[model samples]
Target: MLRVLAVDDEKPLLEELLYLLRSDPRVRSAEGASDATGALRRITRALEAGPDGDDGIDVVFLDIHMAGLTGLDIARLLAGFARPPLIVFVTAHEGFAVQAFDLKAVDYVLKPVRPERLAEAVRRACAQLGRATEAPAAAAEGPPGGPPGAVPAVPGPPGVPAAHRPAAEVTAADRTPEQIAVELGGVTRFVAIADIAYVEAQGDYARLHTDGGSHLVRIPLSTLEERWAARGFVRIHRRHLVALARIDELRLDAGTTSVRVGSAELQVSRRHARGLRDVLMRQATG
Candidate 1:
């Protein structure tokens, strides 16, 4: 079991996080703080009280962007402490993964927090704390045909079930697929869109490369380019689609441009080089 302190400026998100954390069997207690200042105070008190004390917090799930002091600043401060709680950064932006890595964070969870995703973070925290844990049952509470942690549908007017409601009444999020389905050895499995680092085209198929492994899908690279464009994926080459957020380095050697994603260094075609550079520059500046 773990004692957690979830910190976020938004009241609704903070409450939602607390609810999810409490539901997890691995959690002993879940607490909340509105801002970094309050979170730091609680952490300080916990440290003073010692590890076995009831006031101690085992982990802190913190939001990256806040009003006064950012999560990174708080992490730096905690790093100096003799004994600091484990950190898990929760944020809407995907640009802070590197900073989070440098800060030695346990996990980096994106916004619109999914139950299964958060469960994985908790699992990592448990591992670091030398506690063994089985897979989380957080997804068990999710509605059928929806991702874990998705809100349940509300009933329609006049005692009608929500499932019988009109299509127009459903939100866009309900129609979107957060994970991509791929078939391997006659077994079909889903892959989270955020996990894909890059896509490589192979005639009629596209290979989705993730940190764990790669999966070949029937979708074309061109199709993925248009569909994932809004998701920070850019066409770096005719046969390659790279996720902007996953780009670790951009190199220009002898007038040729290339970008590094994970352990792979992908070449940027001359036609798309300028476009890729522009997008990356904009992201860096902003």
Candidate 2:
């Protein structure tokens, strides 16, 4: 069962959202707020009361365009919480989905508030929360060849979930696809996205370096840059798609800026320099 909080500045819309949420079997309870301000207050109170307390909310269905503090602003604030509630953005416009997903929102539902769409969102939230509660137990079980005190990829397979992944990979509010198809040594297998550190372009194909090993795939680097960019993969150089969260350090010596990810140092070109800096800044502040 899930507890959800619905926030919209419009009273009737907020009520309607709460009503729809309450109609679903997955939702154990629902609460409403007229704006982000009230939503934050309630969430704070809930967090102070603890997860087992009646006030704790498992998910938040937020309106992106509310006056004063917009949903994006609210999401960023929540992202910093020690145990942040999953966020789902509800809005009348589609323009904000990418940003919302980047902020780790589980799902984005464009408004007119269809009960079916909202229900799907609730289902996703339930799955996400389940993963959150169960993942720690999986980590406790550990894996073959994983370092001591380190959570790692599931033993005997690239097809299973990976652990201790950067927040940018697993923090998305919903259940994104767990595996991506990759070929290595003429054998194809599903690789967990969380295991990949960065991608390097080699002519037409790209190399995916995981914590355990590396694999080559037939996908173009440009396509991946656009597709996974929202998920923290950024083109630091013309030939590399580095995971922003995996970056260990940025070195600025001798007039060139380079990022150290794992053991490799990749140069950041002038064209993409500021964008990378801005990403790091947002991560720092958020």
Candidate 3:
């Protein structure tokens, strides 16, 4: 179980956060402060009380834009502590994601919080705190049998037949891929990597396709290929990195080779075709 401190300037939002945190089975206690100063004071008292005491907070769900000593400021101050509580930023702004990650935040969640998404954040905090917990179905389920409902097909790259484009990739092994942060209309949201069907390279950016929708992230395709290789993403084309489990069919048409993923069928480059086939066969047999 985890002890949580939820900090927000707004009373209603703070109360809501405390309520949600208290509702989770993983949380032992939930407390709230309406401003960063009060939050810091409470945290200091808890720290002085020591980890063996009931007052020691394990996590702090902080709001970034408070009036006095902003949440970011508090985080920076706490950084000097020998054992600072885990931080999870809860805010309406998306621009501070890079900074929050730099502070080693457990998660960055947007405001008007969803119960399911907050649960995912809690799970991450637990993992960081070396506590064990089960992930909620909405955030944990993998494909072939994702939460039921027809997924809207992601539109493929331009000039390619939309139905024949590659789907996204996810970790097939025991390790769960870290949630990818996506910025949409100034609001940041996290997309679980397990939900992705395929990846399409777009210059320095890679678009992640999933059942919910596609998200364009600022990362290189080569970078993802290397990072996710152990997780089952393979480079079948210079522009595509696809999940082995999501590949529905392999096709050969008059010496040309292609693979189908979800509703998209992507042409496999000659250089990678043999390797792709070998790996697919290995996966099929195993």
Candidate 4:
């Protein structure tokens, strides 16, 4: 079971975050703070009691942009704790995702928060916490299932020290870029990744442009770029990433280039142009 804390300046969003967190069986309890100050107090007091104590919250779902001290500020301060709680950032923007990831955040969820996304973050946090507690055991056991960065064995063969083994390539084996979760009419909806014609980056989130309509999601463009790169998506501009399959034509004149995706015309920045062309060529060849 996980104890969660949600901090947001807005009452409604705080309440909503707590509600969503509580819906998961893994979440033992969920609480809220209207501001960073209030949250800091709760966290400091909890840390003072030790992480295993009754007051300790196991995971924090923090809002990035807020009055006074920001979520990032709290995260940095909490690093002093002997057993700092897992941090999962929740926000209306995607601009902080990169910075949050640098802090080793459990996950970053853009709002309006989808139940599935929130739940998935909780699952990740739970997994991380489990790993933290099992570290000593893992050191003696040669990792939980197998050596680092490898396809874990069913019962990982005995007595092969993890330190002696060579690190293997990380693969998303059998993975498919499928649907993304979005907020629609106060409910969480999934939009098929294949249906997206293009994606526009919005600070900490991305707006998926499709034939049906645009859906704003908390997923950062960089995150999508890494996940969907193998599936034909390429960054056309800082704010726009396009799927190669969606391009109908590429126009270049006087060092400026533009791509046609259906009826929409999007300018491609010079730095990303070569990479885009390369991906398109590879896609065509394969």
lDDT of 1 by residue, 1-286 (tens): 9999999997756765776677677888999999988998999999998878979999999999999999999999999987899999999899999999899999999865666678789889999998866554433554223333344334334432222233333222232457665533222356788999999986556778999877765566787788788898999999899999999999999999999998999999999999888998999999
Candidate 2 structure quality by residue, lDDT tens digits, 194-258: 78889988655567888877765546778778878778889988888998889999888888899
Cα deviation of 177 in candidate 4 (Å)?
Answer: 39
Report clashes for each candidate as comma-separated counts.
Answer: 0, 2, 6, 6
| Candidates ranked by TM-score | 1, 3, 4, 2
Worst 10 residues of 4 by lDDT: 162-171
Q: What tens digits encode model 4's per-residue C-alpha lDDT throughout 1-286?
A: 8888999987646655775666565777888999988999899888887888999889999999899999999998888667899999999798888889988899999876655566668778888877322223322322222212333221212322221112121112112337554533223345578999999886655778998777665456887788788877889999998988889998888999899998899999989888787877886899
Candidate 3 clashing pairs, residues 3+ apart or interchain: 164-265, 167-197, 167-198, 168-197, 168-198, 169-198
Q: Which of the numbered candidates is closest to the native, going by highest lDDT?
A: 1
lDDT of 1: 0.78
Query: lDDT (0-100) at residue 170 of candidate 2?
Result: 28
State each model's CA lDDT, in order.
0.78, 0.72, 0.75, 0.72
State residue 177's C-alpha deviation in candidate 3, in Å. 46
Lowest summed lDDT window (length 10), candidate 3? 158-167
Q: Model 2 Cα displacement at 94 (Å)?
A: 0.7
Per-model TM-score, in order, reads 0.51, 0.45, 0.48, 0.47
Highest TM-score scorer = 1
In candidate 2, stretches whose alpha carbon ends up further than 4 angstroms from where it belongs are 131-286
lDDT of 3: 0.75
Indicate whether candidate 1 or candidate 2 has the larger TM-score: 1
